[model samples]
Target: MSQDEPKAKETKRLVVIGGRGDRAAGTVWLVGAGPGDPELLTVKALKVLQTADVVVHDGLVSDEILDLAPSRARRISVAKRKSRHSYAQDDINRMLVAFAHDGLTVVRLKGGDPFIFGRGGEELEACREAGVACKVVPGVTSALAAAAGAGAPLTHRGSAQAVTFVTGHASTGQVPDLDWDSLAKANQTVVIYMGVSTAAGISARLIDAGRAASTPALIVENASRADERRIVTTLSGLPEAAAEVAGPALLIVGEAMALAQAGTAELVSHVEARGRERGAKS
Candidate 1:
């Protein structure tokens, strides 16, 4: 071999996990948008948002975070709130696949951790089936935000040995099928998402499963947001306490929740009054 023939030009080949004849496929990033605060976003999530060619986000993502993206990036809202859905789940999955096929970086942004009750698994499956590269960036879930905002510790030395996150609603908009017996165990905290509407049934089931009627329970609404509201009550008062909340709320049941910072006296009184009403009815 000749040593002076331009060193036989070394070619650097780019390898693509999934690519077409001449073009490499774009990647889809499933990013968690955090609870509600823009500042809560992970540094990598912020960078991905700023550089993505397209952002498909849920209702939980704040506008402030969206504004951080480049001005030219396209932003689409696929928010699903209770009974109303801006875009169907199937449509979103297809959309992500379609965007990646077009050789454009796509960001599928969800509120809280993408893997935690965010249907990120479904979307990730779709990407894999379509032969597209996908990456996940986790964000702090709302349960954590609720706990933080209320100054409550999800786990404590003697009060809570573990914590469980459960969805309150099923596909049928009914109480989700959860292991009530396990949740009723002591030294464990149970956090229910989208549980406001099913609080009555939840309270009844937990009580039937041996959870104490007087267990300290905290209902947090719009967690981490400026207009956050919290109601402190007992398991027996869950139904009435829930009736007083008109927004997205989380039901936290456990002894550790008793450490939550106290709310206004008026709110406390209201919770107590509702507890009394529920007791009178029983």
Candidate 2:
């Protein structure tokens, strides 16, 4: 052996493999599938879906969007509903790394912007630690969909100057601890995700923080979907209005919500009518 030769390069043998040669290392793409509507998907996200070898997605991702993936791709749903998770976060993270190590293009498809309460950060961190090549393709989040569906501008020139997004429930399935005083401030729009079960508590906290009980509020369910429906009401009536919606919904609060194109009074009446019908059924 040469005196200066590196110890690791003792013997280099060039072996020839049969048919197909060694494949390149795999990569993971964290893609946002957008809110319900497939048309809202970004061009880059669509390309990834069409080319990926495997796709792991959440419950919120619609079937229409899933259909965009290539027919040869394997689709797995690790959807989380209410408190039920089909697969734990650790399991999903491991699955992505394993698939990538197998030289497959893996797509960790999530609903809405992956970084917005979608737990995409956890998955991305996993990839980083594993030394996997990862890319993020942003999509249209539900907040934007809800606002557009209702024709409500999140930040209005006169009524609202800032916007905030909050989750109603914490990881423990309890009301999330948030800054009520700041959330209740005027001239700001607050969009609460997964808040249907905690509507009453949210309303009480906001009222206690000096927000008016009569402040305009809107509950939009399945925003941007064909079955999308919205109920307009006052902050105090959030719980009552929320009771009428049972699908994936968002709670919008602020004076700017009053500017939505929908007829607030009529929707309020409709919600009240539906609530009465439900009570009669029970």
Candidate 3:
């Protein structure tokens, strides 16, 4: 063949294989960052973060938890603070899809259990629709952490036979349309996540549905962390008691709340004494 014909053949070969470069595709991990403590992270979650190429974490994730990812990983903060949403759910979902499509290993880290009130289901559905390879890593939810922090057992032999977790807000940002009558039957623990803003309404609904106004209640804020706080009150005082709480809080209402109040008294007293001592020293 002539030299021109040989060059033409070589050009065609390069065009066919040049696009087949050894570029590694990426994946996304919908990892739960646990309640607030880094040590609460699951081994599998730590392993995923250690090698993640990119991390998109939520507002509640602690700084120590974010430190778990590789130093070279690109970290994106998509946190939604109180009254301020940095990124909407649809936007976050699209961002994850785009990151995965760009061939990067992404970790969508969230605080507490993703399935609880973290809107993880939405993100997971987005990934599925986009055909992105993704997996969910479960973490300790705030309900359990708050209960443990308050030294309360969610289920007691005779005090509580079941435990239910519910959100305070519906999709429309109003009080959820829950079966309040059934929930008022007692002998079960009810934990309300993100219910601080609606504490008064929830309390009213429960009492109207036959739950006693004298029912014990506890508000645990920043559960499982050093700055955790717990307030014990009656169902009628839930709204007022919750008003003093700051940061993400969980409300537990039931006979089990009585146990939490009694069990956590010593810890609360000790904490107070330490605070007093520090104040004196200062």
Candidate 4:
């Protein structure tokens, strides 16, 4: 517990693979790669990644993060886009389990927190069924990144008393069954993942369920990356705002979003203009 001990302490640096049972099987670590930013990776996740013999990552996981693994490590991308999956969930689970069974340390790198709509649960179940040891390393989900980028607090004492995360749609390309009634109540922030396509329907349902049409809304596209874009609007305008987003996006609604800043470029321009005017007057 000394500072020197802290400095000398090695992380979960397992260069050698070990597993349960009397076999040489390895373990599966579901590491969250964070929301597209390599620097956002946790220290533990980074250390585990260094020891990986194989990496199974999602499409959204940037190449920069993947490069952190030892150059000798094997990389397998199981990218999944809307309605297009290079490998089905079942297949991905099988791949992780199979890799671990071969005594190879496997890192299943996912963007954002794995459990948040990333289907980490299904994969964990598969590994348990196969008797493969598994561990999870948490990462900063996109919701936090998006909110931070906009300066919007997900829960504000005076405005947003609570926050909820919900998927935008189901596999059938339709709105998933959600408690729109509860969501319609004010004072709660609603962050919708993978919902840009069904933005119109989602807005209508919330409106019908008694949510205010003028609720402050924000659409963040490609959050936490260099190409990030933030659009601040209102609930009724969600459809139009979403129409401009072609990449992975999140739709956020709540009064707390009223404090959210507009795009960086516009804000910079506004500040610069004010500075010029003040200088001219002086």
Best by lDDT: 4
Total clashes for model 2? 0
RMSD of each: 13.1, 12.3, 11.0, 8.5
TM-score of 1: 0.85
Candidate with more favorable, higher lDDT: 1 or 4 = 4
Clashes of each: 0, 0, 0, 0
Pairwise TM-score winner, candidates 3 and 4: 4
Candidate 3 has what TM-score?
A: 0.85
| Off by more than 4 A, model 1 | 1-23, 264-282
Q: Which stretches of candidate 2 lie over 4 Å from their true place?
A: 1-23, 262-282
Model 2 lDDT at residue 37 = 80
Alpha-carbon error at 83 in model 3, in Å? 3.0
By TM-score, the best candidate is 4
For residues 1-282, what per-residue lDDT tens digits would candidate 1 score against the true structure?
101112111100111222344556889999999988788999999999887887888877878888877777777777798899866787778778877877889889899999999999999999999898999999999999889877789999999999999998888988888999999998889999899999999999999999999999999888777667888899999999999999788999999988886564345557779999999999
Q: 3 or 4, which is superior by lDDT?
A: 4
Q: For residue 13, what is the lDDT in candidate 1? A: 17
Candidate 3, overall lDDT? Answer: 0.82
TM-score for each model: 0.85, 0.84, 0.85, 0.87
